[model samples]
Structures are given as structure tokens and as C-alpha cells.
Target: MTRHEETGAALLSVLLLVAVMAVIAATALDRLTLATRIAGSAATVDQGRAYAFAAEQIALRRVGELVRRDPAKLTLAGDWLGRDFTLPLPGGTGRARLADANNCFNLNSLAAETAPGRLSQRSGAIAQFGELMVLLGIDRGEALGIAGAAADWIDSDGNDGPLGAEDGVYRSMQTSYLPANRKMADPSELRAVRGVTPKIYARLRPWICVLPVADPVRLNVNTLAPEQAPLIAMLMPGQIAIGDARAALAARPAGGYGSSVRFWEASSLARLDPGDIAEQTGVTSRWLALTVNVTMGDGFLTAESLIDANGGAPAAGQAAPAIVRRDWGESD
Candidate 1:
């Protein structure tokens, strides 16, 4: 080949090499930028979580202070770190709220014999649960059976009713799934109980929850949605329509039920079976689930807090308060 041609070819090869190197450099830069962005996002999420935790600590401190001042005023709120708060809970994003631990049932208290055998433990509350089950399209017998199974699952025993899933029954239904004994650790555990179909669970999810083994069963009238009051009313024998319950409640002025005691003692309860009413109502100290909607500037964070309400002080700057569950909820 001629010298000139050879020189031209060498130059071409060098140009090609330069192009390749340029491509590699560009790709590396893009990757570095992407990684940095990812790291920044992670840090932001971490910061938000940290802030949430800080807010929880502030909430607990406020609860202690409020209770010390007036235990009956547990549902009051105060401002902290630029956020407004409350209990029975408060109202802001990145804020924590407390529910009276006394407002729910300790799954541990459920027993085939001693449990009121009522749906909601009020008067005809079980009948209301049965109604909801029917409303949700489950058969009456199936609905009651599902409740029985749920009761059996959380009742600290292995005894199985005809419809309940003891270990043997659960093992027979599905090869991969097993059953649990003793009390449930969380309300979600109910999904694992036999006879509780997914659809029924979906219907009950918003209204029901599991409390600590040490807690007691008490319905919170203030927190209950319209759908739940019927069940509470149904545990008694008198017929209770959802409309009737809502109307009776709406008739009462603000400050939902006077004291928790007065809440249950209303004249509407006179029609309910006293024995069943006694067993199913009232709260305990160890567990609570509160649905709090908070407004932070222009944004909103609606959160449900499952708390362990005790007398001890929380550590500084941290609300590591006993959390059975803390999860994101949709805005109302």
C-alpha cells in the first residue's frame, strides 16, 4: 500500500477508537448521575421516616402530660415542633396520635364459653355482625362460622368447633398453609384464619382489629364508622338499623359519648342483654388503634396508629411507643 493510504487508514482507526472512548465516558457519567439521584431519594425517605418517629415521641410526651393534668381529657391535643396534635389524638402530617388503650378487646379474652358469643358484645351486636356478613354477601351460617373460627384462632386454645379450624382441619384444607394457636399478634393474622374468605376480610378490615393479649374488648364509638355501629347495636336483642343508630348518635351533640362509661350506659342499651353487654363492651390499657388524619401545610397524611398505652415516659426525641402496627391510610 502507498504511504499516504496507510497514514489515512491509521487516522481512521484512531478516530474510531476516540468515538468508542467517548461513548464509554458518556455512559459512565449517566450511570453516576442516576446513582446519585437514587441515593438522594433514599435519603429523603429516611428523613421523612425519622421525622415521623420524632413526631410520635412528641405525641407520647403530650399524652403523658395531658393525662397527668386530667386523665379524663385524654382526647385533647397540643402543638409541638410546629405541629398541632391531639389524642383520644391530633391533626397534621408527620404527627403521632394516641388512642385510649382501653377502647379495644384483648384477643386473649376470647373464650368459647366466657366470650359473650355476641358479634360486637353490645346487645345484638352479633346479629349486626351477621347482618354485615349478609350485606357483604356471605351466608348467615357462614358468617357466624367465620366469626367462630376467628374467635377460636385468637382464644388461646386449640379447641375446635364444628366450623373452626384446629391444626388438623387447616392442614387438610391446603398443603402449604398451617394454622396458629394462642392469641394473634395483630389483626392481619385474622386473614390467615380458616373460613375468613378474602371478601369477608376486606369488608371487616376497616372496622376490626386485634389488640394485645393483655387488652380488653371495647368499641370506640367516636372512632367507629357508620358501618360499625350497627354491629355494636346488634350485640343486644332489640332490632337496630344502621340508620337508627346513626340518628341516635347524630342526635347527641358533639363530644361523641360522654365518658366511655356513659357511652355504653345510654338508654339505647336498655334493650340489650345485660349479660352479653357486660362481657363485650369497654376498653383496656395495653392496646389501641386510632385513625388520625393530619394536615401538614398543603399536604395531608392520614395514618392509623396501633399503640400500646402505658404510664412510662418515652425516650427523648423518639416516639418508639409500643407499635403493634403503623401504616399509610387514604385521605378522607
Candidate 2:
């Protein structure tokens, strides 16, 4: 109740106020620190995505360059971000790589229809298509039907293909599955065809492509995969053995057979009947499908490149592009 007692009470009040201020300040500091960390993490994720996008652009440019040159000279491992990698595409942060188109079936070739024996190359293409189906574990008859359906899809007319699914057959299905009257706008449309199951389509997706609706089918030997070598060989007359083409491939570079002409230049190709080599080499009437698989950290971008023996770049652009397909996974 005296002056000293009152002064003491005032000091206690000030001390309590200071303690409250200190506690509030500490809480605010903790929140600010957490907010900064969250912002930093978000920035890192966005940066990784941007790096992946840049890698895709680089891959497209490389594919365009290959098509400009010989499709055979393309390599995924050369000087990308100052290091080497494989063709299926380099897998790492801030990097993307591409795979050559020669490894896949040229979907455009499915349109050709000259009564069985007339166009030998065309017939060979049909057989090669069957071979591709076989590699995917499909039966020969089913392969033939699927290929024939594709033919019906591309040809201008409405006739049924030899295996059905032509206008008549497809139009008649009670369930109503059939070949399209025009070339496919997208490869996924193949699912609508009679024999192509989801499983079959998935197996064929990597090895086959339907691009640009306008592109033709020209098999690029330089881009052909080992499993697809036989199809390329079959496109030549005299039915070159799959075993021989595979052997010839072993001697070539890991990417592919190199130039198509170089593929013919190999002794193994020469071993085929002279007439067969003459028939296969230098035929560029068909279109070739070039797939550029660009993989960046945490992302995958695919570019479908169509090459003319003459030359040209893909129509796809550098922007927020629509994905034909994409997948993601944790890094090792």
C-alpha cells in the first residue's frame, strides 16, 4: 500500500507485457520461416518442370536435324547438357533424349492394296506388318486382319478388306466396330477397330504410330529396332531371312542400321538374291514414321516426326503442347 509496493506492482506488470511480446514474436518468426521453406520447395518443383520442357524442345530440334540429314546419323547420347546417353532418351534431371523412328511400323503403309502379288514392296510391307504383330505375340491371322483394317481405314474407298472390317463388315457389326474411311487422326483410334484390343494396342503403341493423317509410310532402316529388323528385310523381295537381317544389325551401330543405302551396302544384304536388294534399296515411295521420345526429369514428351526423302520439319510447335501420352515415376 506504500509507494515502493505500488512501484513493485508496476514493474511486475511491465515484465508480464514484455514476456507476452517475446512469445508472440517467436511464434511469428516460426511461421515466417515455414512459409519461406514452402515457397522454396514450390519453386524447385516448377524449375524441374521447366527444365523438362526445355529438354523436349532440344529433342525435337535434334529429330528435325536427323530428318534433314540421313535418319541414320541421329544419336541420343551426343553433347546433350555436356554428356552422352542412349537413344530411347536420356533419363535425368534437366535433360531429354530421343528415339529414332525407324524402330517402328510405318502406319501409312497399311493403306496400300494391290491385289496380293502386284506391288511386291506393298506386299512386303503387309508381311512386315504381320511380323510386327508376331513380335507382339499376336497370331498371324489376327495380324493380317488388323493390318487389313488399317488399309481400309486409309484407302479412299469403302470396300471391306480381305480380313473384313471394311465398310461392309465394320458397318454390319451389331456392336458396330469397323475401320475408318479415312486415315487416322490419332493412333489411339486404332482401338475402335475390330481386332485391336487394349492389350494389343498398348503393345503396339511404342512400335507403331499414326501421324499427321497426311504423312506417308517410308521405312527408315537407320531407325529400325533390332526386333523390327526382319520387317525391314521382308520389305525387300526374295524374303530375306530375319536371322540374316539381325546378324547384319549386330555389326552396325547400336542406334540403327545407319543410312538405308548403307544397310543395303552390308555384305549380308548383298548375300540376298541380287534382284531382292535391287528391289528394296532406294525405294522411298512410302512414308516413314520418326518418333522422338523426349524425357526430362519427372516428365516425358513424345514427338511424331514424319520424314520426306526430300526434307522437312514436324508441324508441332514449342509451347504448352498437348500430350499424345505421358508417364512419371520416382528417380533412382
Candidate 3:
């Protein structure tokens, strides 16, 4: 080969080597930048979580003090039922709200275990639920069906109620699964029941809850909002109208009734016999929920804690209110 051609070949080889090195260096730098961002995001999330948990502790202490101070009743006089507060953190901020969690229908009330793991439908609760559904615009027949299905979902036996489904029915579905045959850990589980469509679930979400136990629902009359009059109406069905229920709630004393008896004795509510529900209804709350939201750097965290004050007064020198459950990511 000629000298000139040889020289050109050498230069081309050197250029190609430089280009390859440049590509490798660029890829390494890009990877390092991505790794740094991921590490930073993780750290921020951890910090936010720590702040959220600290806020929950503060809420627990406050609730304990309130319940201990006045064991007889919990009132809305101080606007404490749905109180919201904010806290300043070193490099972020936290927001929290406290709410009475028992002022809703308990879906678990539809059935209670007659024997260990054996559940039987509670006619009264099912009737009340059916009434609530009807008041909410659901067809009466469909409402009863949903209630029956809900009961069957929690019962231990394979037998289904009149309008309910069993494991066999579920197994035959396009996407198959079996009934829980157990108490629901959360209200969202209702979405899995046979008759609860997404729309129906959304409609019912605001007025119902799932307590761990299957005992009858005990709504705190003192905390019921005027907008929640349907809950009161459902309890007695034909006896009370929604407007009357709302008016009664609106007329409640600022500090709440001195006792459940006083609540039942109110002029507007006195005429109707609360009957079986009289024992189930009360003016004191047993459960409260605290929602905490924390933001740190670019990270955000949300958490909810369920506080069980054991209802009514704690024995003298009893331990502080207990946090029975905690959940992250969403609020119910």
C-alpha cells in the first residue's frame, strides 16, 4: 500500500476508537444520574413516613385525654368531631384530621356467628340495611338481595340465603373466586359481593363501615350530621321521615344529650319506638379515626389509624386509648 493510504487508515482507526469510548462514557453518566434520583426519592419517602407516624401518636394521645376527662359522653361542642390541624416539620409539613368513626351503619351487623364460625342473619339489621338502600334510591327487591348476599359472604356455611350466593355460584363466574366466609377486614371488600356494582358501592361508601366484630351497629346519635339523616331514618324505617330525622339532628344540643335516654326522649324522636335499635343506638362513640398526611421534599405519605377507646368510661387508671389498626396509602 502507498504511504499516504496507510497514514489515512491509521487516522480512521484512531477516530473510531475515540467514538466508541465517548459512547461508553455517556451511558455511564446517564446511569449514575438515574441512580442518584432513585436514592433521593427513597430517602424522602422514608422521612415523610416517619413524620406521618409521629403525627398519629399525637392524635392517639389527644383522644385518650378527651375520653379520660369525660367518660360519660363525647360531644361536638368544641367542633372536635372533625377537627383538622397542621404541623410544621423540619424540611416538610404534615396535615391531620380527627373524625368520629362510628356514626355510620356497620355492614357486619347483617349477621353474627351462632356458633364458632357459623353465622346467622340478623333480621333487624338486614331490614335496616334494606331500608337505607331503598332510601338511597335502590329497588327494594335488589336491596334485599344485596343484604342477603352480604350475609352469605361472611357466614361459615356453604348454604346461601334466599337471595344470596354461595361458593358454587362464585366459582362459576367468568373470573372465579370463593367467599371469604369471614368478617371483612375493610368495607371495600363489599365490592366483591355478588350484587354490589361499582356504582352501588360508591353510593354506599360514605354511609357504611366494617367493624371487626359482627355485633349490631351502634350509631352515635350525637355525631350524626344533618346530611346523614338517612341513617336515622333507616333505623326505624316507616316510623321516621328523612326530613324529621334531619330536623331532630339539627335541634340537638350543642354539648350533646346527657345520655342515650335523653336523646331518645327528645320531642321529635319520642313518639317513635326505637324497639330493638334502642339498645343498639347510643350517644357515645367507641371508635375514632385519624388521617395524617405528610409531605417531605418531593414525597408525600398518607396514613389512617383506628383508635378504640373501649367505648364509655375507662376504668380508673386504665391504659390510654388503644390503636387497634393502622393503614397506609388510603383513607376510608
Candidate 4:
């Protein structure tokens, strides 16, 4: 071949080699940049989680201290569980808010219905929840349906009652799912039941909680102020108006009722059935919910926990109180 042609061929080969090298360099640079970003994000998330776990320990210890001091004073009116504080962490921040779990109605109580169709009985939580909905201005039939459906999801039997939706009804749906046939796993599960629309669930969410146990929703009157009296009014909705409930709560003695007897005597709730009142009311709190939020750089973490301080404190100079239950809660 001619000298010029050979030179041209060598130059072409060098140019092709350079192009290939450039492509590989560009690809490696992109991958390295992506890996760096991923590592940074992971570090931030790890820090946030560490902060959340630390906050949880603090909350549990606070509850333990309260139980040790005086169980009766464990109500929301006290300073222990009501304190809201922020912690300054290294290159981040974390905060926690404490709320009285008993302040809300226990949705698990609906699963405790003994008589399937006797939903109107004042002794059952189904009846009380139904009445609460009615008092909230919900249609009577819809309220009854919501309560019955809540129970139907729990009861072992597959029978579809007047207001309940059983497996047959659920299976026939377009989504084609089956009934839980057990206690609800979360309050959000209520939206899966019949007649429990998003709107209704939203209205009820603020006032209801899914306690770990299948027990009735008991109101701790001492922790409730006039603003929170609607929970007390929900007990006998047909008889008590929201204003009257507030009045009774406002009339509570300073520092709150000292005991169940004092609570009954100080409020019109004394007029309720002795048995029903005794079964569904208390003067102190057992459950506490804690929400902790942690932020580290671009990462954020939130955790919720339900703490059951059922084990009362020991006599003075004894060991610390025991926690009956502690479980994680759904995300906010």
C-alpha cells in the first residue's frame, strides 16, 4: 500500500481506540457517582433509624417511671406522658410526642360482641360505636351497618347478618377477597369491610384505636377534659348531648377525680347502668402511644408504638413496674 494510505489507516485505528476508551471512562464515572449517592443515602437512613430506636427506649423508660411513682397519676393530666421534647442529635434532630391511648375508643371491642344481632344492646361495644356514629350525625342505618360489619369481620362464624358482610359477600366483589374472620390487624382494615367507606373511616379514625387485646373500650374519665368529653358522651348517645358531656367534664374537681367512685359521683355518668358503667369505665389510664420522628440530612424516619402499662407499680422501694404489652403501630 502507498505510504499516505498506510498512515491514514493507522490514524483511523488510533481514533477508534480513543473513542472506545472515552465510552468506558464515561460509563465508569457515571457508575461511581451513582454508588457514592447510594452510600450517602444509606448512611443517612441508618442514622435516622438509630435515632428512632433511641427515642423509643426513652419513651418506654418514661412510662416505666410513671408506673413506679403512682399509677393513678398516670393519667393524661400528669406531666410524665404529656411532655413533648426535642433532642439534638449529631448532624440531625429527633422529637417525640406522647398521647394517652385510652383517650380514643378501642375498636377491638367490636370484636367482643357476644350476640350477633343484638347490636343495639347497651352492654356491647358494637351498640356504643353505633350510637357514637349516630351522635356524629351519620345515618342510623349506616352506623349500624358499620358496627355490624366490624363485628362480622371478627366473629369466627361466616354468617352474614343483617348489616354484616361475610365471605360470600366479599368473594363476590370485583377484588375477590375473603373475610378476616378474626380480630382486625389494624384500624385501617375497617375500610375493607362492608359499608366502611373512606369518609366514614376518616371520621372514626381520630376517635378509635386497635388495642392489642380484644377488650371493650373503657373510658378513663380522669384523663379526659371538656374537649375530650365526646368519648364519654358516646357511651349513651341517645341520652347525652355533646354540650352536656362537656359540662359534666368541666365540673370535675381540680386535679381530676381520684378514683372510680369519685369519677362516677362527680359526673352525670352516674346515671348510667351500674353494671355497664362499671364494665366500661375507669379513672386511670393503661395504654400510651408514642410517636417519634427523626431527621438526618436527607433521610427521615417515623415510628409509632402502643405501650400497655397495665402492670401497676409496686409499693415504695420495690422493683420497677412491668409493661404488659408493647407493639409497633401503623405509619402516620
**For every model shown, what is its TM-score relative to the native structure?**
0.67, 0.57, 0.92, 0.85
lDDT at 184 for candidate 4?
Answer: 64
Q: How does model 4 score by TM-score?
A: 0.85
Candidate 4 per-residue lDDT over residues 217-299, each given as its tens digit: 87777667688777877776577677777876787776766766666565565565544555566766677778877778777
Taking the tens digit of each residue's C-alpha lDDT, what string does model 2 give over 114-200?
Answer: 543221124445566766787557877898888776666666666565664666666677876555566566667777777888888
The top-ranked prediction according to lDDT is 3
Error of 1 at 244 (Å): 5.2
lDDT of 1 by residue, 1-332 (tens): 99999999999999999999999999999999999977866665554555565556665555446445434333323422123354222222444545554443333444323444322222133344455566555778887776667655655456675456666767677565655555566667877877777777776665554554423355545444454455455444245555655554454435445544555455654454346455554322334444555543444455566655543333211233355667765521
Each prediction's Cα lDDT score? 0.52, 0.54, 0.82, 0.72
TM-score of 3: 0.92
As for candidate 4, its clashing pairs are none
Error in Å for residue 144 of model 2: 1.7
Per-candidate clash tally: 20, 11, 0, 0
Q: Which stretches of candidate 1 lie over 4 Å from their true place?
A: 72-137, 155-159, 173-175, 214-216, 221-227, 237-248, 251-265, 283-304, 312-332
Q: Whose TM-score is greatest here?
A: 3
